[model samples]
Target: MSNSLTVGVVQQPAWPDKARSLAASEAGIRAAVSQGAQLVLLQELHATHYFCQYEDPALFDLAEPLDGPTGQRLAELAKELNIVLVGSLFEKRAAGLYHNTAVVYDRAKGRVGQYRKMHIPDDPAFYEKFYFTPGDADDERGQGFTPIDTSVGRLGVLVCWDQWYPEAARLMALSGAELLLYPTAIGWDPNDDDAEKARQKDAWTIIQRSHGVANGLPVLVANRVGFEPDHSGVGGGIAFWGGSFVCGPQGEMLAHAGEETQQLVVNIDMARSENTRRIWPYLRDRRIDAYGDLTRRYRD
Candidate 1:
């Protein structure tokens, strides 16, 4: 078998209406599949605006059951297109419990695995903590990082805030993930100056790229684009810097979408990761025995 995979990302602006948003994603996926993409990823919470800007309880209405309408529609699409699909959504685990979860569907297996976001941010105009409950029932907090096995590849999937943490990526790599995937909804504060905005966006991209380099695995990010006004009047709404991209194992960007609403399809050479790891061998030189302090909250 050829050790290569074609992946696609749908970087779309959110619509208030769920049906409309689904349709937009559908169109993007279809376009990418037409281009021979075997696996596709949609941005974080593609069915709605970055609603965490306002923390009203009313927004909980957006949360849906794991097998709800969104999953049903995605399953149909995956089977029809013969593609593996990964999508992030507001998961209504129960009446009083909720999570920001990423659901994965194999073309032949339907719903395979789901990763509940481990990190929840509570920044200005990004009140994610008010909404999301962290994953991983094993710990006091944090859903343990584990890669999902898929027909396309083993995916080390993480959500937006989780992408910033190197530990998360390392754990996924150590767990046998072939690639790292992040479903992100990141952007700049309109109040920040141009330089600050540029810095923030650059840092985000660099951090994700480092994961691919450090782990010797390909990386994919699907981010939302366009700006949405803050209805709650916290401050100027976020202008989502939609630089969705894919990178090779050596931290080289294979392809990227600009700061606009567009669907991206990129061909990835999986064989390159094995060759790069053979030469770099970072994992082989690991000092795994001496890293006891990594488990601590902080060393005093």
Candidate 2:
């Protein structure tokens, strides 16, 4: 593992057309590589628009197998650029099952590992529960919440909704993850007022930054931008607030992008995690024995 790592986060708008969406993603990847980024991350569901805005059986057609064309394209990009890449996909695990999955590709190594989104949200506009099945808790290799080992570093990659959970970050850190990453597709309802939008965006940003401060690891977030209208017309469309960013171990902003199609290339000092943890020591003071109630759905 190197003492420093150069990373990239691509935040772009998406369309229902897969070809057009991927072209945008590829352009961002190329731009990042030109700036010496060794690892790159694309936002969640970059291959298509936010289809989960409404539940329709037809949307299942949007999903592909793990080694399908989208995955292959991402793997090829990783090899072509000689960089480790993280990309999100809507996976068709089986006939009646699907998942929001994140895939990792190492240069020349092909598809290395994957993490299925564990938290499925069911809200008015973001109806993810109708589409995705949560990841298994314990697989043969202990997959859930496990960090993926890569040439760049051990990556603790989680999807959008997972970012709101501290347990997920803590588990990844406990398993030797060096950095935390979120490939997210979160936005606000267009009908919301400006004050409400600000509150929502601020809360989202603060929660993720707090994850970095608590875990003593860098956090990388890539979120889509632009307004994506709900085709079903059941609700007002979402205006994706594209405030993609990179923060250091101390929750200090390294780089931040505005609400536009942008790619951020930032150098992360890997040594900071060790130095920060040594002084903060949040991990060492954990009262694990007294936290057994966390497993229950509710304590009442």
Highest TM-score, which number? 2
Runs in model 2 lying further than 4 Å from the true structure: none
Best by lDDT: 2
Please report, as a residue range, the 10-residue window in candidate 2 with the lowest summed lDDT: 135-144
In model 1, what lDDT does residue 133 have? 92
Clash count (model 2, backbone only)? 0
How many pairs in model 1 have backbone atoms within 3 A of each other, for residues 3 or more apart or on separate chains, i.e. clashes? Answer: 2
The residue-by-residue lDDT of candidate 2 on 126-150, one tens digit each, is 9999999999986875469999999
Colliding pairs, model 1: 135-143, 136-143
* TM-score of structure candidate 1: 0.96
lDDT of 1: 0.90
Against the true structure, what is every candidate's RMSD?
2.0, 0.7
Q: Write the per-residue lDDT of candidate 1 for residues 1-300, one digit (tens) a residue.
A: 259799998888887789888888999899989988999999999988888998899999999998999989998899889999998779999988899999999996898888999989998888999999999744433247978889888889999999999999999999899989999999988889999998999999999999999999999999998888898886798899999999999999888999987877888999998899999999999999999999999999
